[model samples]
Target: MIPLLASLLLVTTRPAVSQVILVEKAYEYVQKKEFGKAREAIDLAAANESTALDARTWYLRGYIYKELYKANPATGGELRAAALEYLGKSAQLDTSLAYRKDGQAVTRYLVVTFYNEASGDLNRQAFDKALTGFRNYLQARSGEPPDNAYATALYYAGYTSLLMGNQSGARQYYEQALRLNYRNSSLYSDLTSIYEAAGQDSLAAGTIRAGRQQFPGDTVLRITEINLLLSQKNYRRVEAIVEEYLALYPANVEVMLVAGTVYERISQGDSLSRESYFNKRKEIYRRVLSTYPDNFSANYNLGITLYNRAVDLIKAQQYDLDIVLLYEILEKVSGLFREAKPYVEKAYRLSPGNLNAMRALEGIYYNLNEKEKSRQIRATINEMK
Candidate 1:
């Protein structure tokens, strides 16, 4: 019983006395301006089990570190980070509220220091350093009241993370900033890109949906969600989503373009009713051309749609045996080519170097018996080669 009591007493008293001595040594080193030695002593005291749980020990350690941070003329970040970290610990562990104001002051100083650093680094385009600085500022002020600056800093962290090719980190920072209601519409697009790049299609779609809710009528996200559905080959779902968007924005060029492309894809793929699919494609681009007359894609697509219909009609005539019916079909096929001529010509005029439009124009002019126009288009196409 005597041995056990002595061992327990030694275990209790040794660390207690050591902590007191270490604290005294830390203060002495500070008075001598030996901050490195002071840091060492306080770090050992901080690690000792007896002193580790004591708020007073952490408080003194924090105060000493703060002084060391101030004494250093170097912009070496380690000392300031250590000061804020220890002070935060001291403040958190101090249930009596003692030293709370001092801890708060140290945290504020760290925040301001980092904020200035981040601003300068950003101006210099030192993205990694800027991100770290903003992150440090936010972390120092964590658990404090958040404001606009805090939210903007979070977004900058995510933006830098993205630029540095850290998609997962970018996602985390963006999600946090969004939860705080950071109002940047481009955030959704970039975050969606990150998730989509990682093959997280469901999460990408969900992010677009959430961003749409936060920023109503954002066409980029709407288009993104539609493209996501299209990528999955969920044509019916894509159609439904595209229709929903078109209802909201009837004159939306991008949505119309996507819708036209989707229908054209199905027509070229496995659709049973190719005529109806082609008709849908033609109608969408026609509406787009009516609204945006010089629209390159719409003009080109409408021309191609008409050209394909004419080709289908000619192919049908070859499958027939009746001479009179073949003649009538041939006449209609020529008329279809004539109908396609203007749109293809418009497309080529709007975008002079477009190979597809030139090719279509060459085909239309040749089929319509305009040898000179066809020859000129063929020479231009050869030059492109």
Candidate 2:
């Protein structure tokens, strides 16, 4: 009679003991990052109704699956699906617990994470997958997302459509994003390129013009406008733009370079005498030097200007003047040469077989009558060949 009663008590407590023990073990395994063991224990606890349906327990399952999905994304589709399932269950268990009133920030954060995961798929050119992920998030959300969220999602969707060669789809999405007050300069730039590619130059220009008004200080947009003018051979307009900007920002090196380049282009276009052209070139270089004494562009342009002057003097049988100008250039521009050498060497280091820098060095050495140094450089060039 005593043995029979003891057996009955053991049978009655077995289920309760198993449920508690499995849940405790699962928690311990999760703490240790032993995901496989944790998953196994959780599965066992989940099968037992007494432990499986707890809201916190389901939430932990979701968190674990989300982490696993992140660790190995290629094989994580099912895991992420499982996470969504468990999280949904948790929310169903307690609607108020899905997002806290005081910590509504966490909800926004999760929304952003969902968006980021979708965007990652977009970046990988998995347009269908990205769209599916985004749609899933939209469907799951109780209300409409904020303006920025809508804009970002639309922009990425447009960009992906563009990549997939669906210009109309891209345009639709871009318009949607724009409607949401999305004012991204890069998106505008991309749209301009797309319009231009489709042979809609007028639309491209108009888009860029609109973008310029929105982003008034964007130098890239200005440069884009300048390039457009150049491509159309509107030299006078480019010159006017340069002159206007130069008047506004006289000390800006980039503006100075642009102005100098415009002047050089004008000089080149005129089929004038070499002397007249060289004189104009000299004036441009002098103006550059006046503004930026130690500027790389100014110094380099000065060296080229002096070199041209020396060449003209030599052609006119003025050897003494030619030698004097060459000497002055070497003395005044030696620092420029040293400063530029590192950048040129870096290019050569990246592409060791490239002869452009070596050839430039050879010319400089040859001009200086350093035949032995030129020969050494030539030997390295030959080895590369």
Q: Best by TM-score, which number?
A: 1
- Candidate 2: count the clashes: 0
* Model 1 spans with C-alpha error above 4 angstroms: 1-181, 266-270, 313-321
Cα lDDT of model 2 by residue, 1-385, tens digit: 5699899999998997887788788778879988888888877777788876676567667666766776787677788778767766665665557432312332344456567778888878788878766756654453655467677777887777777788887887787777777988866777777777677889888988888899987766776676666666777898888777767776767766666666666666765754464565556656766765545555555445444444444444545567777666555444444434443444445555656667655655565566897798899988887
In Å, residue 81's CA in model 2 sits off its true spot by 6.6
**What does candidate 1's lDDT look like per residue over 1-385, in tens digits?**
5699898898879768978799789879978878789889989988988778777677777777777767762554677767767877887789999878877776687678887888788878898888888888888678778887888888888988888888888889998888888998778888888888889998888888888887888888777777777777888788888888889889889999999988876776665868898888889998998889999889888888889889887766555468988888888888888888889899999999999999989988889899999999999899989
RMSD of 1: 9.6
TM-scores, all models, native as reference:
0.57, 0.54
**Colliding pairs, model 2:** none
Question: lDDT score of model 1?
Answer: 0.83
Q: Candidate 1 at residue 178, lDDT?
A: 83
lDDT of 1 at 227: 73
